[model samples]
Target: MRVVMFGYQTWGHRTLQALLDSEHEVVLVVTHPRSDHAYEKIWSDSVADLAEKHGVPVLLRNRPGGVELLGALRDAEPDIIVANNWRTWLPSEIFDLPPHGTLNIHDSLLPTYAGFSPLIWALINGEPEVGVTAHRMDAELDMGDVLLQRSVAVGPHDTATDLFHRTVDLIGPLVTESLDLIASGRAVWTPQDRSRSSFFHKRALEDSRIDWTWPAEDLERFVRAQSDPYPNAFTHHRGERIRILSAAVSEGRYGGTPGRIFIREGEGIVIVTGAGARSGRLPGLVIKRVRTEDGTEHAATDYFRTMGGYLTPRP
Candidate 1:
């Protein structure tokens, strides 16, 4: 089958590589334009460069249906278009252009965690499982029939960067399997239950803010979800800001005070939260690593010490 692939970032790069290495012919590749340093620099290579290396034509279109982009896509005349986390929406014409219609590879299971930053959102919600789905594209965003789906456990120690990389690695061979099934016309697609569907927006700094009032377990999940590649969960420490990188539910708990910094045990500092103490259990977290707003990374305990002795002093 002749394939045209579209995506950006690490997810897109993996899909492009997979199709190129597969049995199908990739006629052209489409990706978002390099907006600026912020978006472009995160990725080591653009999808265009990879396509060029494989001698497959490449198209960078900020708007998938804009005049030039639409023309280029139509000219490529691919049998299938694989949407691997393509950020923008495609017009009906483009989605319907290819012979086998468009199939999208979403990071999350459809009808749930359907929008952007799915792995981040899953961790933020403290979900035990994270997975991907291949679906048939529709007019609505992520409102498509599911072709195939698989999930992996989100370990207690997992971070957004960890899950993001795992998902990208899974997408490579996993997608090739989907293509093989589709190529053989043995694809069994499933319709998503809209009743269980929820979409999320791209996370912003506001969303990453850690609420002191939230239970320590909730805060811990939030911290882990946003840490590292996804943007660290933040809080104001003695009027100066700090980002929480690695945290986990600690064993000890006293009373119901949230965000009260307790003694550091081993490699972390314990704090309280509701999610941490569910089912009549004492809930809290110990932060391991912390980064200050002033561009310094430090052990959480040491940073607490450097913060004008605020960790002690008693609130």
Candidate 2:
């Protein structure tokens, strides 16, 4: 079967690689242009670069709309259109162009997490599991009929970056199997239940700010969710931005105030959380690693020499 693919970033690169390795013909590939943003991580093997390496036609477009794109697709005459991690809205002119229709590989199980940074949101929200969904493309975002879906456990210590790598591995298998089913004319479509659906907006830097008022467990998850390549969960110390790279829910706690630096020991820096005493024990978060604005990484003990102040939001 001939395929026209639309994708971007690492997720896009993986999907395109899978299609190229499969028994399908990828006639055209559409990818987003290179981003100059400092925060964005550029893939070494981008979709456009991969497509070029494989000798497949490539289009660099943020939005896969307008006449030129349509004309190119019409010429390619693909059997199906496959999209993975494509950010923009694809008009019906493109999604409806192929004979077998368009199939999208979404990071989360459809109808549940229907928006950006789903893996991060799932981890931050303390979900027990995370998965990917291959579905037929529709006008609504991630509301398509499910074709293939697989789930993986979200371990207690798992970060968003960890979940991302795990989820990316599933994409290749799901896409290959979904395409096989479609090619064999045995694909099953399951309509998504609207009642179970929830959509989330794109997360910004503001969303990564650590709120000490939250429960210690929740704050721990928040730290893990945004660690590493993502903007770390951060708070202000004397107007200096300190990004929390790793943290854990401490065993015992005594509450003076939420966000106060209560204990500074060799183990870690324990900050009291808003979850007050329960059964004579208060909740606290033990921050193990941190990074400052100057890009200096440090252990919690070294980072906090004087431990009486609080971790507060910038005013």
Candidate 3:
């Protein structure tokens, strides 16, 4: 099959690589230019570079569709269009251009976690498993018909960075297998259950702020979700910003206002949490490690030398 790939970052890089290694012909590639956004910078393997290395035609577009882009797609005459981690919505003319339409590979198990930073969001929400889904592109965001899905278990101690490495590896194989099925006319597209669908916005610096009103277990998961290589979950203490590098739920419940830097527990410092914390039945967040505004990491014990303050949402 003659293929046109639309992708950006490591996800797209892997998709294109798989297509290159397969019997299919990758005629054209479209990808986004480099971004300075916090999340966009990570897992950024260049789709354009890989396409160029293979001598395949490459087009860089922030959003798909322009007269030139359409003309190029027509000229390339792809049998199918395969996209992964494309930053923007693709117009029908672009996704529906080829005979087989578009095969979109997403990082999460669709009908849930359907938008940006899916792995991070899933971790924060404590989803038991995280995986990749290969589906046919439709008008809505990740609301496509399912082709194939492959998942990996999300361990209790797993971080978003860890989940990323696990799921990104699934792209190449999923793309390859999905394409083979489509090419051979064995593909059975399954319509997604829109009732079970969810859409999330792109992550920003503000989204990583710690909200003490959440349960300690949830806060712990939030810390793991925003683990290193992505932005760390953060809070403000003594008018200074501090990033949580490691945390856990406390062994005992504490009674205090949410965000209060209370007692020390085991190896971490316990911060009172949850809206119901005053009832003294809620476990506090045990902050094990943190990074100060100066980027110096410290044990939470050392960082909060004398606890008795609040970790605010802002300065």
The global C-alpha lDDT for each of the candidates, from Candidate 1 onward, is 0.78, 0.87, 0.94
Candidate 3 segments whose C-alpha is farther than 4 A from its true place: none
The numbered model that scores best in lDDT is 3
Worst 10-residue lDDT window, candidate 3: 57-66
Clashes of each: 7, 0, 0
lDDT accuracy of residue 102 in candidate 1: 92
122-168: candidate 1 lDDT, tens digit per residue: 88788888988889898999998988888888998788878877777
Q: In terms of TM-score, which candidate is strongest?
A: 3
Report how far off residue 292 is in candidate 1 (Å). Answer: 1.3
Residue 39 of candidate 3: its Cα lDDT?
87
Q: Cα RMSD (Å) per model? A: 3.5, 1.8, 0.7
User: Which scores higher on TM-score, 1 or 2?
Assistant: 2
Worst 10 residues of 1 by lDDT: 306-315
lDDT of 2 at 73: 93
Model 3: per-residue lDDT, tens digit, 25-96?
999999999999888898899999999999998999998868999999999999999999999999999889
Q: After superposition, how far is residue 163 of candidate 2 from its true place, in Å?
A: 1.1
TM-score of 2: 0.95
